[model samples]
Target: MFDFIKTQVIGVTTPTVDFIPTAEDLPAFCARVSNPDNQKNFDTAAGLLKYCMRVGHWSVFDMSNIVIEIEAPRDIARQVLRHSSIKFQEFSQRYAVAQNFVIREARLQDTKNRQNSIDTENNYLQEAWKLKQEQVLNLVRENYQWALDSGIAKECARVILPEGNTMSYMYANGTVRQWITYLKVRDDLGVTQKEHVDLARKIKPAIIAHFPFLEELMEK
Candidate 1:
């Protein structure tokens, strides 16, 4: 009955909302990129890279930041950290032994805020899900501890953890542009949660002030 693995969302992020680029600056920026003569005077490779980024042709969003604390399961965190450039800081459950860190999706589903659970609108788990999730977390934790006790390093013991083992992190500055892509990709399905949609809506307006033509296009 106990097939254990662990997972949870342990963080979410909010962007820093100030700092706007000037309107005149946007046109001049476009001009600088458009004119090879002007581009020639500056550092060639650096200038070209900046030019492509300004218009959102590629991942220029890495320049700005939006720090979110994601309550991600350990399994999810592993995937999340694959973006090598992004920064992350998580709470250490191994060190913080006193807190009641256990959380079940079932318990959160009954709460005033429904966010702690999955937004699976139609797939009602009833009872099987609760049991399944428990088994997963238990197995992951037990195996991890067992490996450590048996002479394996804690680091090596964590290999069996699943995507649901939750953790927290601050995806610091230079993440906003990637977030624009995040908004676009996640929004298409109409299945994204309202909280994220609202965040994208808010940040886009601010970002547009720095990039008017972009504002004109995206806002339309």
Candidate 2:
């Protein structure tokens, strides 16, 4: 007999956003060039960056760029691609096998907001949903394997995969201005998807760590 009650619940892989080291001081250097009178010193550069951010001089931030690699589910990855300013090179499912599948706790749809959800209070319902989700994912995995075994092309077989499957982008590059905008919008819990918000939260720390000058701007 299938032990639905005792089945181990599958969970989503925690998303990661890592900063690829590059010209960290380039933004400040470019900002300094914008004003020939500006002194050539670390304090002056930091002050210029802060003032630019405060006064909405976003063009200076575009002088330098950051590269990041993201590991997230297909659905969240799609959301990340919606940022037009970011250049991304995603993993090709047509060539590689799709493996990781994310299974998250089910939430009740928000009655007032079409784009939001509210947590469910019923433990039994949550557990039942988890069981069902696991079963469906198991079936999906089996079907995918069967298709491969039957000599179906990976591109064709991948169509049957769910949006919850994990995907990665080895190279995602964007300017500081673009990245700041991306974080401001996606990190808002009131409007953005919970999982995507979590991913944005992870990215912020990396940005601040590399370019400490931007910490005040990031807070705003």
Candidate 3:
């Protein structure tokens, strides 16, 4: 059972943005200069909102930073490290002992989040998963000891380990914009982990405030 465990940020570096609106030019700027619905102001702020609603000049949102450390089964780690720009480093199961690994105590399993199995009634699923984890952990210990005594190489002996083995990882989100895009897609049905959706929902407000172009559409 993975709990509402804490995540430690390991590293992060994000790009800086300088927006030079494409709509700032004469005709296009005038076209979207007013909130057409809100009709009064003609300043940069209103024009910006109107333009963002129309042409979506959200280039300034490219700047922001985020980092997260996650623990998941090695089966899951294989898929999560695919995003190209994200910086990643994950634990190696074969080399590291499971006893050294951290187990998350989950109160509820959000199957919607990350497509993982969940526990809705009294956390039974989490408990079962924990017991399974303990069994696997014990297997690793027994095998490792047996291999050591039998003089077998550690690498060769660990090949039989199961995929449910735990691993921890650190990923840096280079741009908050990139993550916002990720949130929109991943938080939606069919693509989201319930926990991830919750996290994305939590992150949404701050992003909107920092990058107002992203704000209106999200609000709508």
Candidate 4:
């Protein structure tokens, strides 16, 4: 039901079992771990990886790397930006076009659960809300364009745009260890914002692809 949140993981490069090894360095490292003398019995890289996670050593996870690009409403963008550990380069309204993409549906506030939403019972009313949001956003866009044409600075003109209606995108760059911390909190069901949880779920599989034992690590 939530199609508004768009994201992608690009330029992914993950580490092998070694903490500081190059791409060509993993097989030999795994072999050392699997050496008969050591009796570690790690038959494969994946096995050694499992051991690393099982031991609760997160530093090894720092070897895995990725950059995630996300296109979302400003509200969601604000939530994502709260993750101070990860580096982010966001689309700036001061420099670029401010695409005011409105979120049309109005979610019903749950009285018992503050900061949570429930489905509105009336589908017809929801449609009306969509139309009204579109009308307001169209006016906003027109005024924004007019200000730009009238020689107003983009930085100044952007003040007219509503934070909830604007679209902001960003690239999040970090290691798997950083992301593990992010996912643990943002992916939790207790999180009031469903969009953040949706994004975490979507990117988890990509993380698992590089670190096969990560799902088990997260469990621990």
Can you tell me which runs of candidate 1 are displaced by over 4 Å? 1-64, 78-124, 168-172, 190-220
TM-score: model 3 vs. ground truth: 0.53
Of the two candidates 2 and 3, the one with more favorable lDDT, higher being better, is 2
Between prediction 1 and prediction 3, the one with superior lDDT is 3
- What tens-digit string does per-residue lDDT give for candidate 4 at 18-69? 5534431243253354464643333455666666656666666666567888
Better of 3 and 4 by TM-score: 4
lDDT of 4: 0.71
- Candidate 4 stretches with Cα past 4 Å from truth are 14-43, 215-220
| 1-220: candidate 3 lDDT, tens digit per residue | 3443234444333222233232222222334445355322334544455454456554433433556665555544554565566667666545654444444444454556655545356667668867877777787778767876797766676676665454445454545446556656645534555445554565565445444455656654
Q: Is candidate 2 or candidate 3 better by TM-score?
A: 2
Q: Where is model 3 more than 4 Å wrong at Cα?
A: 8-55, 63-67, 92-119, 122-129, 145-161, 195-220
> What would the TM-scores of all predictions be?
0.43, 0.84, 0.53, 0.80
- C-alpha displacement of 212 in model 1, angstroms? 14
* Candidate 3 local Cα displacement, residue 4, angstroms: 5.6
In order, the Cα lDDT scores of the candidates are 0.45, 0.71, 0.51, 0.71
Candidate 2 per-residue lDDT over residues 1-220, each given as its tens digit: 1111111111111213232123445566566675656524555566777888889988988876677777777788888899978888788989998876766667788888867878787989888987887888898899999999999999999888878644444456887788889989998885898778878887787777666777877777
* Candidate 1 C-alpha lDDT tens digits along 75-132: 4345445555556666654443211123334322426544433444343553667668
